[model samples]
Target: MSVLRIDTSIQGPRSASSALADVAEAEWSAVRPTTTFVRRHLGAEPLPADAWAAAITGGPLPEEQRTPAQRDAIALARTLADEMRHADAAILALPLYNWGVSQHAKTWIDLTIAGAEKGERLLEGKPAIVLTTRGGGYGPGTPREGWDHNTAFLRRIVADVWGAELTLIERELTLARVNPAMEALLETAELMRKAAHEAASHAGRAAASSAR
Candidate 1:
């Protein structure tokens, strides 16, 4: 089996979202020992911010008439889209950044959409686990209850647009341990972390079973 794993964490080893993804991948690997993973690190290697626009503009032009940038952008978009289209399962680590989706993840998502056929569900009927972490709590009754603008957008794309059987693992207050101001919330943060990891593990095993 082939699984597409996309990590968009600039924090490297310290990333909470990536840590959850590792848990999921480990569980999946345990179940499917011979599975192959196609990896993409958008945070480590960001797509060109202008690539999506170039690809969009180049779509109607003949190959010979396209500029070098446009040609490259189109090719890159196709590669990203193909990765999702062909994956048997997927794991995505896309943390919330500045109250919204990070530019790195957004660019990757846009390019993938640009490359696919219009309205085509690239991951149709496939299992996809999305691990998203937040530095602050935004749940009901919290001061920032309505401030989160990341998770819902992801749900729309992964489940509604791509048509994946989505399993979302979310952890909030990720900065509690590091931010002195959030000391009182440390316990809550730890609990959230554990829950997210547990969810990821369960999702991974489920994904493996479903794929099989």
Candidate 2:
């Protein structure tokens, strides 16, 4: 069994969202040391914007006839699709952009969403946790809280396309330095740690049972 960490945090290590993802990963490692870890860093080697557009425009791949770039795109798409489908559990480290997901995040979703043409939901019924990093507070209250597009859009895509069980852990790292705000953020991370471990233990048990 293993966990796939999909780090979509555009800011790399500086991303608060990625920090939470790391905490969650550490919890998993402690609770399930036997589980392998797989990392997909979008910043390092982002998938092409049109990798899976094959279903709509390019049609089936003809490897020999395709350009080098086209071949590269298809290969990444296939690899990503398989990873999403096969992982026992997955996490998406997200960014809050203009009150919604970043363009890169949306592109990843479009390529991986199970659709009429794709036929199978590689993410169907799997569990996924979203770690959101943001500059301002947003989620019903707080100034930019309306920008809390993280929960809603993620829920919709995961439910409709991937069918993955979902959890969201968000922290406003930029707000931490403002007096007690840092404490609040740390508390949120603790809550995320608790939840991530419980979920991991449950998934690990399920996998064991299935194997038996």
Q: Write the per-residue lDDT of candidate 2 for residues 134-205, one digit (tens) a residue.
A: 665565666665556666888777666677766666555454544475675766645554564455445434
Clashes of 2: 2
By summed lDDT, the worst window of 10 consecutive residues in model 2 runs over: 203-212
**Residue 206 local lDDT, model 2:** 44
Please, what is the TM-score per model?
0.99, 0.73
RMSD of each: 0.7, 4.6
Say which candidate scores most in TM-score: 1
lDDT digits (tens) for residues 87-171 of candidate 1: 9989999999999999999999999999999999999999999999999999999999989999999999999999999999899
TM-score (C-alpha, index-matched) for candidate 2: 0.73
User: What value of lDDT does candidate 2 attain over all alpha carbons?
Assistant: 0.63
